[model samples]
Target chain A: MDKFSLFVPNFLPCREYFDPGNNNACPGCGLALGVRHVYKAADKAMEKALWENISDTKFFGIKTNPSLLKIKQKKNELIICLDNEAGGSLRDALKKQMPGMAVAEGFKYVATACPSYPFDLYDKVKKALDTEGKSYIHILCPCPEGWQFDPENSVKAGFSAVETLAFPLYEAVCGFYTLTVKTAKPKKLSDYITIQGRFSGVTDSEIAEAGAIVDKEYSKLLEKIQSSYSYTFETTGKVY
Target chain B: MEASSGFLKKMIKCSLIEEGTAKPYKSGAHRKSLPEWDRDRCIKCGVCYIYCPDAAVYRLDDGFFDVENQKCKGCGICHSECWFGVISMVEER
Candidate 1:
């Protein structure tokens, strides 16, 4: 079938696939935007692979959340893990559990957020999937309700999270780490927290403490990437 | 009794609803603000109609665009997408 024909079917209103108009997601939900970008990116990547005569592949989406622990049904529960809570990162946890799959950190650039960043990151993800068989993209999808922000400010809050260095933008492809979008000067953590209602009553000392944690984590990531370069090149047989 | 059971099974089979037929529950009650259109400045380009995710933007018979407040979730997508800047999201009283 023609590419357009395939694309048209996916766009058609279906309960299975993510439809634009009928989604139950809250207004300005970052997860909705993130999911949409992933689908669009995967579609383009699949089309490119088809044109190149590569092996046909299927896409499977899995949403991992620790909140599923409250559910009783097996079908309703997928993966139970604390993602961004209690000093635990989901990408690291997944890496430890499944040593074989490539874990990548997908992030949006403040300069080119939304449409541009998602598409760019998708291409990187598609490449990783083709080479490594499986890839996990840890996207930072902000919650307006939980974060206590107006729905209209979801995009702004998402951007702020990255700018504050609370969520660094990097990709870990086959154990190799690469910072996708580098910030010349990251914004203060307070700038991000003050806008959200959840952090409305937070004190300056608390903000400083959180900022310190982010800085420490970011430095650790940089050190890990630097130390892993030689090993990554040895194993992958290609310099990243 | 056997004939009644057979008829009940047939009715159950026929009662399955068609996919995509169920209308979404009204979401306008969730809106904190509503988009108001200024007809004097509207060029009727229909950009708002195309970009509305909730399908709240409707074109009147006279080529003027109107938002169905009952369906609008006050996402401000139409306000952002309007090229002529004729649409403004005003606080809903």
Candidate 2:
């Protein structure tokens, strides 16, 4: 049974899982954007690592596992990649369960408005990974498909979202989390809403209300990063 | 084709706005009380004729653009492209 708790997982991330013609029409679904972004990020990371260590490391093909539970035998490095859905929460529970594995949670990896992982939840997972000497990179990919926008507007929406603090762009290293791009104050939520079709139902007044929610959330996240504390490394030197 | 000296109007479909709303001819700028048609001022350059995307402008045998005002979407393609700036897009409101 799929456990549903604090985290939500986009279990079906593969294009093959999608039927050519389905009865359910999810035109502005953000989950699809999250899957595509994760796949792209994985490819880029592997390529960068390979180029950096051409002589020392060999390129190996990756197999997609339903659950990323396999322990690295000799390399002593285990990477767990998950979306910001129930599956990600399950992974977080597993991290609490297994002390030997390191977990990295992706945030806003796909949708401009909908972040992959809850920003607060991501903070905790990122804290755990850093203490283990593991690297955590949060990807924020905006999707015009998810936003119900003209497909061409994806890149513009993506940039605006970051600048507006509708989505925060930053990296967490070790125990320190810093905002790479800072906005003095969150921009009007309408600036983020009118461009996309998913939020087309949103009115000018409702837009103001939604903006308040976004601003409150962004403020809380900023406060958390500003006052971050050092986290204890949980996993033993089983692999390291 | 049967040629008429009077205005022959047609409607175009645009998903962006309300359907079946008959907009006046390019809407009502081509009617009289607008301006004098100076044939000498016009070079018969065919700029307006070639520039209208909707084919709303046609050159008559008399060496002038016969603009089908009702058929024009007011897209301003002709007005902007005209080297002589003879064509203008008036406000619909």
Candidate whose TM-score is highest = 1
The per-prediction CA RMSD against the true structure, in angstroms, equals 13.0, 20.4
In candidate 1, the residue pairs with backbone N, CA or C atoms under 3 Å apart (3 or more residues apart, or in different chains) clash, namely: none
DockQ of each: 0.10, 0.02
Tell me the TM-score of each prediction against the true structure. 0.55, 0.36
Candidate 2: which stretches are off by over 4 Å? A1-137, A184-186, A229-240, B1-93
Clashes of 2: 12
Model 1, range A1-240, lDDT digits (tens) per residue? 333422232232212123544566677565655555444445433322211111322212343332211111222211111122223432231122211122332212111123214444445444543442334444555666777677666656666767776666665654656677667899987787788776666677866777777787778767867867877778887767
